[model samples]
Target: MSSGHTAVTTALQPCGLPEHRNCGIREVLDRIGDKWSVLVIAELSPGTRRFREIQRGIHGISQRMLTLTLRRLERDGLVLRTAFPTVPVTVTYQLTDRGRSLTHLVQQLADWSLANMAAVAESRRRWDAANPESMIV
Candidate 1:
């Protein structure tokens, strides 16, 4: 309330319009939009796998990141985690029905990425070549 300042508000757009409300698809994408999430789903698409197996299947992922990603997926009901009593206790992660359904969509995205990665790379190269100043060291 100082310096003659006043709060301003604007009317929100209609819910049916994407600009106004949070879209359901956007919410779902937010849940799994990370690169690691897609890769993790791909690794688990075949069948149930233990934590170590999943980690080994997807290279370049740190243990902490993997744990966090799995926890998020589990919380979203897209993955099921089972732990077995053993000397050190063993745990496995498997896709739930919902998760399996999502695999197909993620696979399509993977296919698209594979098919178009070269084109995307070429576009980036052209852009960088045209605007050298934009390139970061």
Candidate 2:
């Protein structure tokens, strides 16, 4: 195993470390650390929302991407998906208890980002100025 993976395994275990081919921490992080998942969870933090409402709330997310994100969140037991038999088959999503727990953390991170945005921007500007060749755009 790579040193990074071994570090994670050791940190996660710390007592009677088991042989882990796959780690639950990595799996959960892979889902929640994605760009859309955190946003989607935060959007649903308010209350239940229809498909269009979620899409509209999160700008720049394509319909297909939103659908996939919602599906993944639902599968992970973070979001509850409810479908109604209507003329257009209406669907709404709300955070489950598990989702609510995760939302609290996401909100805290958002708050921190907003609070330190200027500092972060300044840091980025300095880094970019110092490393012009490393700039992507």
Candidate 3:
């Protein structure tokens, strides 16, 4: 909700103030707002991939979290899940058209984080070095 992109569109103006304010965008933002969801969707962009494949591709994502996030994505129509009619029944997740559209924005944010992390780290280091009061003396 903090981001301006979550605001309702001009097409919703006919709905009046209250109804427009509560437009469906809130749910969409809430779903994609988490970093894990962005990464998960991005990983699925290359092609349909199994649960384990996605988990392995994105480091530090726990199995439980991956399951929950994927379910949410599927529920939101951002991802499609298919269970193969095999002896073992394999399942795969892939981005829907809507989810694919988010790739550039999500990828840009990731790139920006990678590019700026060093400067941000340096700023934090400087602040910590200057503020000795907060540290254990």
Q: Return the TM-score for candidate 1, rounded to 2 decimals.
A: 0.81
lDDT of 2 by residue, 1-137 (tens): 77665344344452224765454676888899998999999999999999999999999999999999999999999999998999989889999999999977998999998999999899989989999889454
Which has the better lDDT: candidate 1, or candidate 2? 2
If candidate 3 were superposed on the true structure by all CA atoms, what would the RMSD be? 6.5
Tens digits of per-residue lDDT, candidate 1, 1-137, equal: 68798675875444568575765766677778888888899999999999889999999999999999999999999899999999799899999999999898998998999999999999989888989988453
Total backbone collisions, model 2 = 0
Q: How does model 2 fare in lDDT? A: 0.90
User: What are the per-residue Cα lDDT tens digits for candidate 3 across 23-98?
Assistant: 7666777789888898898899898999999999999999999999999999989999999999899998999999
Clashing pairs in 1: none
Q: After superposition, how far is residue 15 of candidate 1 from its true place, in Å?
A: 7.9
Query: Model 3 segments beyond 4 Å from truth?
Result: 1-21, 131-137
As for TM-score, the candidate ahead, 1 or 3, is: 1
